[model samples]
Target: MLIGVPAETMAGETRVAVTPETTKKLMAQGHSVRVQSGAGVAASVTDAAYQAAGADMTDAAGALGCDLVLKVRSPSALELTQMKPGAALVGMLNPFDAEGLQRLASARLTAFALEAAPRTTRAQSMDVLSSQANIAGYKAVIMAADRYQKFFPMLMTAAGTVKAARVVILGVGVAGLQAIATAKRLGAVIEASDVRPSVKEQVESLGAKFIDVPYETAEEKEAAEGVGGYARPMPQSWLDRQKLEVAKRVAQADVVISTALIPGRAAPVLITEEMVASMKPGSVIIDMAAGKGAVNADGSVGGNCPLTEADKTVVKHGVTLVGETNLAALVAADASALYARNVLDFLKLVLPKDAAGIEVPLDDDIVAACLMTQGGEIKKT
Candidate 1:
């Protein structure tokens, strides 16, 4: 099989879907690898490095016209024109984008949106969300620390004492948990909240306080549990109670990192204007859910905070809001490396080790969930 790795064309996107290490493995497995010249340059992977690892450096059109194409973002209209029909494509294709899926289906491409994969034991290695979210969580805290005027740790000087920063994390998923752990390492007092009750132990294990908004009704309890390890939208009654609890913590917080999101849904408003107004003047907010989430009525990026402008940093209510959507892309090297490995793991399911053909197993849950488009139809699950 011929495999292509193309340069990402999304604004501010620096991640590549394939790296030299993974390229080498595929080349050794009787696969012909084609990479766009300088595809991995932003990630510090030189063209010569890819060549050394047995990849044929080619133009974007050349690479796109292959048996299989791997990318970080979905192809643009021009790119779609260059691809061969029936060719396979794998990437974090933003499955929520109905129009994008439709375009891909119209092109008759067999597409796999990796973000849609199940979070099961067998699919762990191929979990792109967890791998990338881990990086975003760590980077969010770093962004907060940079914007904050004071130190995270308390200091006792001969002149005076500097108090430790109070950090709050919303949506204690993989990213939220990492935010707590990262803030704790910086000597800040951390508090985290999530709809799911199971993560309380995970939060406590990391030495952070878990903000509990107990479910008042059975419906709230069921919704709070979430589905397939991803969060579900909560009832308004529960959300109102949560807001009350979080508002109290936000008032005194030095840093707030919001990671709350429901898959294929607009990001919930976790940090409201009122909450932002009450925070300290020098406090920082790193909204990791900025541009990647918030599917509006017209399908624009909405954020955890309604005031958050995607990919832009805003100073509101005398507080700093770091609404950077590409925190993982900021650390492009490792993020692409981990994502490339995840893609490689998923390939084992469809691409044969010894043969030259791609096989899509409909019986496999991972494959079925990821197969958004096949045979010119939107086969969304």
Candidate 2:
């Protein structure tokens, strides 16, 4: 089978879908690969490296016109429209995007959403969320560090003793945990919180204090574990209590990182205007869910946007708010490697017995599970 890896067309996107390392693995499995010229350059993976790994470099048309297509995000309409009927596409497809969904249906392609991968033990290694979030979490801290005026670690100098920066992390998932660990490593006095009780130990293990506030038992536990063990929406009451409790801490912290998200749903607005205003000037807030409208303050809302820097954007609450667009792209090589692994694992399950051919197995659980649309129909829960 020929696997196509095209350059990511999304603005601010620098990560490639496939890397030389993964291309080598694919070739070892008897799969031929075609990467769009310069696809891996931004991620620092050279075309020469891909050639050495047994991948053929070509133009977008040649690459996209393959047996299977792998992408970082859904392709542009022009790209999707060019797909041959029955060609397979797998990636982090935003199933809820109405226009994109419609274009996908019109293509009559076998499409899989990596975000829809089942959360099971067998699927752990193939989990793009975990792999990508790991990098995102690490990058969030770096972004916070850059925005913050004060140093993270405590310092002793001839001038005087400088105290460590106080860092707070909200949401203790893979990204949250990574943020906690990264902040701690930088010598920050970190405090972490999550609605789920299961992560208290995980937070404390990283030498960060855990914040526990009062809330209704049902809402508390449910919000912590999130929906389907994925992040979920929080009730107004719990959110109200959280705003109050977290405001005081935010006011004092040097940096705050918000890593809350719900799969295929909008990100919850964990911080309000009061929360941002309460914080001292020069404090930083990295809203990981900003792309999903998850960041909101009294006057401003943060979520994913088509906004570019020239838009004269302002984080007005005296808080520097960064809505990370493609944090994983900051570390392209690893991101591509992990993304390819997920694509490869998924192919192994969906591919036909004959290496050269594969039928869209609509009846298969993994197929039905990840396939968002087929035959002009949307298969969604």
Highest TM-score: give the candidate number: 1
User: Could you tell me the lDDT of residue 132 within candidate 2?
Assistant: 94
lDDT of 1: 0.92
CA error at residue 130 for candidate 2, angstroms: 1.0
TM-scores for all candidates: the values are 0.96, 0.91
Off by over 4 Å in 2: 215-224, 294-301, 304-315, 359-364
lDDT per residue (tens digit) for residues 253-355 in model 2: 8888887776656666667666777788888888777656633344344553212112132465677777766788888878887887877787777774456
Residue 263's lDDT within candidate 2 is 63
Scanning candidate 2 in windows of ten residues, the lowest lDDT window is 304-313
The residue ranges of model 1 lying beyond 4 angstroms of the native Cα positions read 292-301
Whole-model alpha-carbon lDDT for candidate 2? 0.79
Per-residue lDDT for 53-96 in model 1, tens only? 99999999989999899999899999999999999999998898
